[model samples]
Target: MDMVISNLQQQRAVTEQLRREAAIKRMLVSQAVADIVKFINEHEQDDCLLHGFTSQRINPFREKSSCTLI
Candidate 1:
């Protein structure tokens, strides 16, 4: 009876430890995804700013046009 009780306690402890490790892994994964999204947003904002600054000097391509296209 004492041996059975000891085995049950060990199993319970192991299960709890696994659950805590899984929770920590999930939190790390979520944080990594959030960081990636933030980096992408910052890169997009930089691209938009660059395009805005260069747009005035850029020329439009036209195959055929009666009037000047800008």
Candidate 2:
């Protein structure tokens, strides 16, 4: 049916648009990761990375949790 065909075409168009948006997001993430890699490489010899762990987990491997529960 003509209506069925039109619906299929519309779905395909929507899918293609979503694919394009996902591809763009992938590109942005790739670029961000590349920038982070470059930054880490540039700072590999410094103490910068160690202190850059999770917000307050500066010494990530330490036995005591930074926040003590009451």
Per-residue lDDT for 1-70 in model 1, tens only?
9999999999999999999988873458789999999998889866645466545444343244478679
Query: Against the hidden reference, what TM-scores do the models get?
Result: 0.36, 0.36
Which candidate wins on lDDT?
2
Report the Cα lDDT for residue 62, model 1. Answer: 28
Candidate 2 wrongly placed segments (more than 4 Å) = 26-70
Question: Mind giving the per-residue lDDT tens digits that candidate 2 earns over 1-70?
Answer: 9999999999999999999988873458789999999998888767555555555566665678488689
Q: Single out the weakest 10-residue window by summed lDDT for candidate 1.
A: 56-65
True-structure Cα RMSD, model 1: 13.1
lDDT of each: 0.75, 0.79
Clashes of 2: 0
